[model samples]
Target chain A: MNTKTRDTLGKVGVFALASVPLLDGIWRVTSGTRLGGNPIETLEHLSGQWALYLLAITLALTPLRTLFGWRWQLKLRRMLGLFAAFYALVHVVCYVWLDLGFAWDEIGTELIGRPTITIGAVAALGLLVLALTSPRAAVRRLGKRWQPLHRSVYLIAVMAVVHVAWKGKDGGEDALVYALVLIALLLPRFAVLAKKRSSPQA
Target chain B: MMRKAISSNEITPESVFLKRRQVLQAAMALGAGSLVGCSVDSAEADTPSAATTRALTSTGSTDFAGGENWTPEKLVTSYNNFYELGLDKGDPAKNADWLKTDGWTVEVGGACAKPGTFAVEDLVNFNALEERVYRLRCVEAWSMVVPWLGVPLGDMLKRFEPTSNAKYVRFDTVLDPDNLKGQRSSILQWPYTEGLRIDEAMHPLSFMAVGLYGKTLPAQNGAPLRLVMPWKYGYKSIKSIVKIEFVEEQPDTSWNLSAPHEYGFYSNVNPSVSHPRWSQARERRIDGNVLSAKIDTQMFNGYADEVASLYTGMDLSKSF
Candidate 1:
């Protein structure tokens, strides 16, 4: 397939894949399937998991292109990042509306008092900023500042992993897996940075 | 027996019950389908010990009454925190079929006069099975009202003849890593252990639950035998008990050993004292309502009237 056709198909594939969890959630609610006794908790978990997964996928794209000479994949980053932000939005909405039942006082208390919730909120805010600045017009307007701002995704990803680690009851095997993936993604960047610092003349 | 008035809200809606019934039927069909390839003898041998149903009698005690709506039976059975089966709430129900409850026995040892292994049947038949509705509050800030059928744990403990040295009672869950898959992971100390003070164990409120909702206990709910101390957080009520040890010193508990700062030995449900990770002042009741706001959690899960004396002088905050 040509570049335009491949990109179009890829974007559509990404959109469809990102939507599977949301659609599956709706289907489970409508079909009376096992959302396992606590449906709100289930939905909250599903949305949060997908949000983290999509964020990880978004981060992996740059590493994939750098490692494997793939230019076309770069165009899909914005879309994936936006999808990640969307899922994060859903996750927050589930917590506030469904889980907490719009109890703003309790929500405020959790956002400020609870470490996991506070970390999650900050990471989500970072994703929101990234999503807002993702547009071509915003990108053009920001110029050099955009690159540095977007790099905060790395920090947000770390905070998100911490949020997950702190919230889990079982020893954080799930968080460890995410942390490992993040480490792998960062290693190549660190290696290049280390090499540049060592050979300044080059 | 005088029947306690059950509020209308306490009853599960027919629609929800029917839907759950269908889901359970589907799950049972799938379970049977998987067993199709196994030899008849093997399948027969694999039959759950609690498969046979037994009648239960209600003691008609209103001491621990809360008049809260009963969490739907499906939710009670499916939503469990039994780590031996799995970590996820739903995992216990899904993985529990592997648990072999047949010929289960509890070895009574340590500070007790009669240290002997007794079959689960003997314990269940020790006293007439009585039904008690209890509010089960988890450390995770979730609550459920369940109708548990069993005898008062104190009566059964007395039969074992505890000596003066028996200051604490420690209960141990079954340790079959092959069947209880969660045991394979080091998420927690294996063969989950929990303990209570000698007086706490002898408290009339502490019960040995053999069944729930007027049926034999499902493996996920800790079939054969489990403790149901209504006043304490749910974890204190250990499940699938295989051993009961009366110790002179305070016994080490699984959660307390895992996180001393978080889970204390007492673990009585106190709204004032919060878990280090989250607030324990409020809890969401899993009553089939997805949109319901969390209700204020009660001290001792609303059994403060019956159990406040157990911690008369000790500061709950410090002990907790």
Candidate 2:
């Protein structure tokens, strides 16, 4: 693609990402939601939406970049994953700081006690792994194993759905939509895996 | 992409000003409604300690009491949080300005001697405002001490002169989805309907609240009219009313009919019968700077003395 066009897309990503905190801060202010109830629950809901959004965006990047054949889209994967992690970090902080209130005792009680929370914690950890290793150097170091480590994203998305389903009392269309999006994203990977296994390597 | 930061200064005093404004608005409108049923309100609020006040007047009047709990902020912020009109408990102060309160009719029908409609102005312009500190308990397990202004329910019910067969009184709200946009949600039925046993309706504590915090009931909190029963859970108090009916049989209430197991016709707060999903033992008060809370709830929400007789022989657990 042209350098000017690439430069424009880069500028757009920077502009969009920069405004996210402000956009979100405005929501909490105007929505006038009195923050009560489980902080973990609130953060989970807030971050879960963002995580799904990022996963959707990450999956979209390939389809978008391939269909448009744009190199500018390549830079977006890290930014999108980072956004996903930003939300995930909020989710974890809410769980750790607000919900558990930084008490190892309370954290252990919920993590070890509740199945939904345990699965969710693991998914958050998986996302953390991907976020930490998202750099090109990490990919280069992993070599052949990079694809397998990156594949943990699909697992993270699935666990996220289970997490939401278990916490079903909170009203929304999120869990249902996230599951459908995950299915659509994962179907192609499964089909490719099957094709690779079936083809005779000459 | 719009965003606004939550205003600082800890306690925004605007909410308190709104509550005082609400009562004044109702007091202005009270002069228009029927005057005969509201005299009792003065005895409760104005006379302080008259043992015979209960016997002095059958109709309720504008009463006031000041406890440590009576802060201007709590008075306004603790209002019934029905969001059909707006959010932020104080949204009524801003949005209720557009409500068409005058020249409105409150139709009474179904098993009544006079099945006709009366103008809301007649009741407000004529009736005296009585302020009663009624505790409002939401189905979601939060409580508020509300100083409601209105007349006794019996006085209002007697106006229509119900037929001998009338054993229940049903209230209907303005249900036009276009006008009441929150009607879109399939939560509880919109144009909310709530009912009371004929005897319960006649109870002195059961009043039709027109004003709160010594002012007119804001449009958001069921402007022009609403129900107040210190005994029942808050949902039973339907707002923005348009119709009233006296029925021979028990009428189906919105929440009760929607999910009978969770709600009941005799939805008197019984701490023993737990809501299937959550415990009703404790409630959080609406006064702001609210961080640590969880007050023990009483059976019939402390209204058993006034209302327990109605459910003398009934099983509250099954009914609830």
lDDT of 1 by residue, A74-128 (tens): 8889998998999999999998898888888888988888899999999999999
Candidate 2, position B185, lDDT: 52
**All candidates: TM-score:** 0.89, 0.65
Error of 1 at B248 (Å): 1.1
What level of docking quality does candidate 1 show? acceptable
- Deviation of model 1 at A191, angstroms: 2.4
List TM-scores of chain B, every candidate.
0.84, 0.75
**lDDT by residue for model 2 (B53-152), tens:** 1111113433322242542323343243565554333344344444466566888899877778787755443345565777777766667766676777
What is the C-alpha lDDT profile of model 1 across B1-320, one tens digit per residue?
A: 22446644238553454456557656654764454321111111211223344445555534245566677766787788998888877677767776898888899999978889989877777347788888899998899988888898999999889999999999999999988888998878988999999999999999999988667788888987899998899999999999999999999999999889889999999999988778899998886556667889998989888899989999999999
Candidate 1 lDDT score at position B317: 98
True contact recovery of candidate 1: 0.43
